[model samples]
Target: MGRQLATALLRASSLEPRHINISTRRPETLGGLFLDQRWVSAVLYSLLNMCTAQKLGAGKTLRLLNGLFETNTFTYHSLVNSPSASDLNSPDDLFPWMSLVDAQTKDTPLTDLVLRDKGLRDCFSVMYYNVFSNLAEG
Candidate 1:
């Protein structure tokens, strides 16, 4: 199921193989990995804050973040898989905001930030709500 979704996303978007993380096992105990309700609220708040700071509307901010996610995911994957072989650089030229977050977060990768901290995995409903709300407002 996950692989199917990943394949669809890859074909629909500019995502590459490295932009995806697939886990075959479904661990019953996610521990701190589970997306809490508080994290959902935090994701919304952070999105709004980021949109305001960047002077971009919610829709544009979402688009920009999407691009950043793709770029960062590939870069991070290269670094982890073959640090010596990969000559991947930061997306500072294209996504300064993403680069800043990547630098400030230290050990946390941008892909993890978008997928885990932003609750993208389990908070799809919340994200859909936000997208619809933004579309309605715009």
Candidate 2:
């Protein structure tokens, strides 16, 4: 499932597999797991950036995210079905359809949206920080 999501994101974005630092695991490494959070963060960031770069509408963005989630074995619900919220107070509250609709309706660029929306700015900041920190640790 992870591989599928990664592949799809890579195909959609300008990122290359080497950018994620993916490598073959050896038998000796089997006992220990190396779940690189940086890889996940990087892929997600790239995916979001691609969406913004393409100026995808809310419907298309939602579908892309839903498709990625559905790649896993678990039953995934559509993001559109999630209850709407007036404000996004935190990262957990991010992705309310209202925000996407606003962005789409206004045709706002990602940089402008990030600057104008505190919740979105904070979310991106957190993800960027995590990616850099994980890279340093790794």
Candidate 3:
């Protein structure tokens, strides 16, 4: 059930395997998808960034799952847009984010990260970045 969902999401996002992050509380349950353990930390950071970028409202959450229970990808974003409040008040929360691609790490080769990693490379075609507009009613 998990693998099937992950595969479906990979196809949908067109992220290519390298850009996806598969993680779980139980690594054994994820099976072979795990690449570097440090990826989990990266994922958390990405999620936190996205969440902090947007304006808080109903909030938005997206999840990408795969078949064979091999990979599981998740993302979420939430923010508060208020001119009266300063950006300093924003709360940074990542919960446990992970990504198929670690764009920030300098040492790791992207090709190796993509071609070598099983689930991360084989999942999607491209990674997406979302932008939010911060505008106050005139």
Candidate 4:
């Protein structure tokens, strides 16, 4: 269930690697949760460790993301404007989002689900910046 939501959010947001953060009760517990590609980040959340709060800050998780992305920090325009910029409004922009949404709706669990390395589940799960794959690059 955790991984499903994580992957769904990833696909919905265009596979931005930086946006996803996985933290387990211990660093060693971060296993499973790899759905996108090599460029994606797989963090390990931990109960003893509260690093997420540091980055997200005080009780503003959803609000922070809303404002962050709303400012166009990583919007389609932002990507297209970057040095490696491409068209965010193109067909490519919508494909991954649609595909990801479909996978989630169809109940396709993330590939290679495992819990090796002691990464505890239920500690934490997050969706952060996306790193576009070659498929997204026309």
Best by lDDT: 2
RMSD of each: 14.1, 12.5, 15.3, 16.6
**Candidate 1: lDDT over CA atoms?**
0.38
| Per-residue lDDT of candidate 4, residues 21-131 (tens digit) | 434244236553443421121221111012232443212432332242342122322111233224323333221111323333332221112122112122222222122
Candidate 1 weakest lDDT stretch, 10 residues: 91-100
Q: Mind giving the per-residue lDDT tens digits that candidate 2 earns over 11-39? A: 75576645665324532465533333334
Task: Give the lDDT of residue 127 in candidate 2.
Answer: 43
Using TM-score as the measure, name the better of candidate 2 and candidate 4. Answer: 2
lDDT of 1 by residue, 1-138 (tens): 233333333443465655445343333343323443343334433443454465664335445545533333223332222442243343321212233233334433333444554434444443333333333344
- Candidate 4 is scored at a TM of 0.19
Q: Which stretches of candidate 1 lie over 4 Å from their true place?
A: 1-32, 68-119, 122-138
Which is superior by TM-score, 3 or 4?
3
Model 1, residue 98: C-alpha shift (Å): 21
Instruction: Candidate 2: list runs displaced more than 4 Å.
Output: 1-29, 36-39, 71-138
lDDT, ranked from best to worst: 2, 1, 3, 4
TM-score of each: 0.26, 0.34, 0.25, 0.19
The clash number for model 4 is 20
Per-residue accuracy of model 3 over 1-138 as CA lDDT, tens digit each: 433333434443446665544332343354533334234333433433444344322222223112222344322221112332243332242222223355345322333334445555434311211000001110
